[model samples]
Target chain A: MSLQHALLGVLEARPMSGYDLVQFFDSSTAWIWAAPQSQIYPTLRRMERAGLITGDDEPRGPKLTRTVYSVTDQGREELERWLSTPHDPSPPRDPFLVQALNFDTIDAEKAHAVLEQFITEQEKAAAEAEAHRQRLLNKDTMLLKERLTRRDPAEHDRIARLKAHVFAGVAAVARTRAEWAREGQRLLTED
Target chain B: MSLQHALLGVLEARPMSGYDLVQFFDSSTAWIWAAPQSQIYPTLRRMERAGLITGDDEPRGPKLTRTVYSVTDQGREELERWLSTPHDPSPPRDPFLVQALNFDTIDAEKAHAVLEQFITEQEKAAAEAEAHRQRLLNKDTMLLKERLTRRDPAEHDRIARLKAHVFAGVAAVARTRAEWAREGQRLLTED
Candidate 1:
């Protein structure tokens, strides 16, 4: 599915081992679209079987071989097609919001506690997103560093600006959630 | 599952037929948690078998018997437990943001078009959410009306405030997304 396209998009940048891709996903794309390490190996195998990607074996140590994955031209075409297509927005499914909708079922104290906990969690998430944004802005991230090393100078700027914008978007969402939680807390406590 | 809990929570308010529950979900809870009519009947059967809810048969017409479902005492306890428990925040999975992260793979014009389309969609969503919030604020919703009729006068304000807070929270999220989309469009268009 989209994970396959995501893998193709990442490999389109440069050849990477399955381990490197997992690291990349964790460091960069975890906030937007996460795929566990357990899913990565099986997906890589499936993509290879489908001819979207190719795996080349390389010797890592004595009696050990590692497979490095790279996207084929067909994969690049598929990535482009997916990028151009419009995607339906995912349906909202916030459990905290669901709880808020049914707040009458619980006492005010319990509701206030939930909002407080949500605020704390949201603030922590916003801080992490801000840190990640700063890294992308400075081009200090491994993903961006790799792109800068391999791509044209102009393309590097495009990539950095787009990626930084995505991180900023993430940070904004986290901040909004925190603000909403604070408002809920105030409503629960105020006269 | 959360859907089961959601059904129980709504039934705790008042008894509802399966058809009525589907309408309720479509009008109110769809913003937070969505379940299709197809899944609703099957889940209801399972819940009844499990003794979480009870359905009383009533004559609808000459030949049809409608079942009105209400949460049992066990269902009420289950709902209270769920309401008191803290839920983990859902991980983000925005496909637009995912495509934005890989913007270098696509042409600049295509990227700009995508961002523009996103902005339009987000603005529409924000407007819808704002309308919903206004309805909650004005106490014009059927759900709120029912609660006002049944609950104590003192509890009415608390319920309205909490539910309105949830709707406001939804509005805020939509506005944030629209803002993010606008920013993305600007980034795409800037020199």
Candidate 2:
């Protein structure tokens, strides 16, 4: 599964405790591939059982121990194989679009309100994505900087450019969503 | 839960056999909310148990009968409530973007090829969405025509506009994806 590969990829960046991985996902990978903390612990156990990752107990404080995860050699090979493989686009699952398809059941006023709210939410998302794009471009984000330091100097430019490309893609999607919502609002108001 | 509501909405249009619903989902709703044929039968049974839908056996031949499903009053009321509720945006689960984030692990040429393939797929999808939008605008799609005939004449215009809005939204998303892919391709090529 892609989640397994994603976990391997993240662990390959640096050894992280489950708590740290959850924080990393929330702060960075949430925009790309989100996984809830509830799912993380179970998945980590599975990955360990499958020999893709190994967990070692480390002292956290006077009496506390935490399990820190790191990718195995097998995991690195698997992550690379996944990276080389072509990706299939995911199935459509947009609920707002589903509602719009059944618009005959709702009033025009309610439809307009929904469109407006969608536009507002999309605008906020676009702003956040744009800010993220700027952070990637500046090479100031923590994940980007850490990845840069870990890789060969020859890879520095490619890594920075590719990551920024992903954020730019996210911003474009948000802008298009906002644009579509505005168009829907206009259609509701006109005629 | 959204899938349940989507099923109810489709049934509100007209009674359909499970087979017909599978065909409908494949032809029409696949672009908005895809449901597998495997899930359809089980979900239909669950809905029957919940009293959200009623199934009546109709003779198809001398010895064979088919169950046709239609929305109950409770189903319609539930659908209306769902339509009135605000929707939260689904989290991103794009694997290609995840790969991009870990670009340091992949060779540049492979990344370029992947971006090119993605662009081609998105361009094809955008064209199909555009064609669907045109059909909705002309009120020529079978589903749109069916809903129009069943609803009040005064509601016809609103229904058409709303449906077209959904397709337009689809078109915008596809176009944005294509654009992002193109940008990714360029990033891979330059420097």
Instruction: Give per-residue CA lDDT, model 1, range A1-191, as digits (tens).
Output: 77887788778767899999999898778887888899999999999998889999999999999999998878878889889877877777667777877776687788878777888888888888888888887888866787688878876666777788887888898899889988887887754
Identify the candidate with maximal DockQ. Answer: 2
Candidate 2 local lDDT, B1-191, one digit each (tens): 88888899888878889999999999988888889999899999999999999999999999999999999989888888888777887887888777777765778688777777777878877787788888888888877787778888886776777777788778788889888877777776666
Residue-level lDDT of model 2, residues A1-191, one tens digit each, is 77777888878878889999899889878888889999888999999998989999999899999999999988888888888777887788788888877765777678777777888887887787778888877888876676677778786776677777777878888889888877777777665
User: lDDT of candidate 1?
Assistant: 0.82
Candidate 2 residue spans exceeding 4 A from truth: none
Query: Candidate 2: lDDT of A60?
Result: 84
User: Candidate 2 DockQ category?
Assistant: medium
DockQ of 1: 0.68
Q: Which 10 successive residues of model 1 chain B have the least lDDT summed?
A: B182-191
